[model samples]
Structures are given as C-alpha cells and as structure tokens.
Target: MEATHRVLVVDDDADIRDLLVFVLEQAGLEVSWAETGEDALAKVREHQPDLVTLDLTLPDMDGTEVCRRLREFSDAYVVMITGRASETDRLVGLEVGADDYMNKPFSPREVLARVSALLRRPRLGAPSEPASSVEEPAPVAGPADAELDVGGGLVLDSARHVATLDGERVMLTPAEFDLLRALATRPGEAWEREELVREVWQGEFIESDFLVDVHIANLRRKLRRAGSRTTWIRTVGGASYLYDPS
Candidate 1:
C-alpha cells in the first residue's frame, strides 16, 4: 500500500478549519490543523506534512512569514488561502514560496481538487542513495529531448529534477522548476500563457494569469541568484514567454 500523504491545515476561522479538515479527510489524506501561524509552524516541524493549506492572515503572524520560514527547512507544497483577491496579495504569497493560491469563499471541492493535484505531481528533490554506493547513476533524459544546457553556466537535469549554475546546485521550488523546465524544453519558442499553465500546472485551472507571472518572476530571481548573468526567460509583450538564452 502507498504511504498516506499528510496535510497541515492552518486557519484561524473555526468553520473554515472544520470544512477543510472534512474535505481533506474525505480525500484519504492524513489531516492536521492549527489555529495560528506559530502553531502551524510547530505542527509542520513535528509532522513534516506533505502539504500545507495556509491562511494568509493569521493571528500570531502573517502567513507569508510562515511560508518563508517553512521554505527554510521544508519543501512541502503550500497552498495559500487569502481573503483578499488582489493581484498584489497573490503575488506576495507566491514570492514567499507558496506553490498555489486561493481566494476567500472558495469552494471546498476546489480546495480539495487543488490539494489532490499538487500531491499528484512529483517534487523536485532527488532521493538519497545508499552510503555504500560509490558510482553515480547516469542522468535520465526527459521527454523534452534530453537535459537542456541553457548556456550562461546553467544546466537543467530534468530527470533528477536538478538545476545547476556555475557548478553549484540551484534550489528551486517545484513550481519554479517546472516552469523553467517547460520553457527550456523548446528554447526561443514563445509559449502562450494558457499553454504554459496547461503544461506546467498539468491542466489545473488558475483563476488569473498573474499566477504564471508570479512563478516566472520567482524563477528568474532564483536563477539570477544562482549566478546566471544573462536573462534567459523573457516576456514577449502581449503574447507569451520564451527561453531566450541569447
């Protein structure tokens, strides 16, 4: 039998918490809940859940801070829940390392669907091998025509879900890595926003195009921090984004 995926639901609203717990439990996941950001962090540390449904406004601290802190040690997927529907709010959540965002008054079914979709996707980190194994396994090529060398000392190993710049590993969120991999696959191809959403998000419905932009921005930031001097991912102005390594 497959191991049960764990979820940490963080929300101060009693009704919302109960609703999420019910829906998630119905989905066959091991669900836990916290009423504050501090408690949420504690639960995360203790349980090391596979995913977290975090409310942006928490009594103890802002959810973005919680997300930032969580990213320091955990790569578990985070879906931010916010009462505010502003683009700025969503972008802030994404910048803080949230894998997805949902506005207030969201359907319980939609929330469950998002959770299910996220859990179904593979994470970026590689599994550890036995200490006695001296030889490294050969890198496997992805469907995008082998690993992409995006110049500027950047290499994307899709098979191992690893990205390296200047011979150093570049830590990326699962969403960022997927977006980069999708663009790098067909360099210079201006992929439409919808197409990218379908490809990277696996057909999950995103309410706004800003979701893509936010993830793209995060990807660029991480890549630049990883020591790449040139701009690789570029916007096409009213069209799409392309991986232009020129």
Candidate 2:
C-alpha cells in the first residue's frame, strides 16, 4: 500500500496555496492549506501532518516564529518557502527548526521532489528493537552496522537513527543527523559542500552552499546544548567541513 503522507501548505498567496495543494494531491499526498501562520499552527494542531510547507512571510507572523513554535510540540518536517535568498534568512529558518528551505519562483516539480525526498528520510530517534528471546535469531548486519562512536561521549547509532552526547539524547532533524553521520563516519576527512549535499540529501542538487552551512550551524548548536565542549565538526579553509575530535 502506498503511504499516505499528509502535508500542510502554509502560504498567504492563494495562487501558491492552490498550486501547492494541486501538486501535492496529484503526487498522492494528503494536503491541507492555510493562509497565515496562525492558521497554519491551528491546522497543524488539528491534523498533526507529517510535513509542512511554510512561507516566510505571513499575515499573522513570520515563518521562522511559526517554526519555532512548531518545534515545541511537533516533529513534523518543515520546509520554509522564501522569496529572499539571503544567507541570514536561510540560517534563521534552520535555527528555528525548519528541516529544509526553498527559494521563491520554484517549480511545482521541484517542490514535489523535495517533499518526496524529505518523506523518504528515516524518522529521527526511531530505535531498533532487539530479539524477543535468546532463542530468536539475531538480526544480520547490514547498513546499520555502520554505526560510529565519535568520541567525546558522542555516539551515532545509524541502525536506530539516534545520537547521544554525554549520555544525553541530542534531538536532530533528519538532515542534521545525516550530516553528522556523514562527517563522523569518516573523521578527519574534509568534505566539500557538494559532497556533503550529495551524501546527506541523497544526491539532490542543492543550489546554495548556505543550506549545508545552516544545517551545520544547527547541528553545532544542538551539540552545544547537549553539553559538548569539543568542536566535533570543524570548518576547513573557507569551503569544506570535517569531523575533528581534536
């Protein structure tokens, strides 16, 4: 059976809202639309959608504020839509917990593609279950076996989609988790922005380097919040990032 993912489209423009609804519905997703940030929050509370497409400018409040509020009680994937391509704007969106961002004048095809990619990502903090009994067969190793213990009390459990720092759980968006995983898996290797994008976003062509930078910033903030003193992810030159425990 095809999974019926629910998406909440939050935009003030009627044309954009209708267009998003049409495209998302055509893509076999259940979509709900809202014209303001307040309405979007209400709909989110009501529907508990799997994802939300939020516009930066809204009648009641800014999208970043909405995203901040959403993160308080919701884990829904948030994709911010903005007309401005400013680095500050992108960083703010990510800082407030937006999972992704899209610049304005975007194609419905691109929107659908982004939505599909976000939906395909594994849910954060979903842990794997152990065998029921000793008699039960042990699970075979696979991609999940690539888990890493990145020192400084940080552990990345790829199989369970969990990250812990100093024995405290570090909540991360799927993108942030993937980014950390990619860098931690190969510590001390400087990863170019393009390579990190391909690995974390699964080959999606992200046009702006700011996307990767913003997500990295968010990841760092989360690590700090988890009481980490060492800089786990480091910037190399002006272009690449690497995992350096030192």
Q: Pick the candidate with the highest TM-score.
A: 1
What candidate 2 gets wrong by more than 4 Å, as runs, is: 1-3, 125-148, 203-205
RMSD of each: 6.9, 7.1
Residue range 83-102, candidate 1, lDDT tens digits? 98688888888998998988
lDDT, candidates in the order shown = 0.78, 0.78
Q: Residue 212 CA error for candidate 2 (Å)?
A: 1.0
User: What are the per-residue Cα lDDT tens digits for candidate 2 across 36-155?
Assistant: 888899999999988899999999899999999998878888999999868889888988888788888989767866776666655543432221111222222224645578888898
TM per candidate: 0.86, 0.84
Score candidate 1 by TM-score against the native: 0.86
Q: How accurate is candidate 1 locally (lDDT)?
A: 0.78
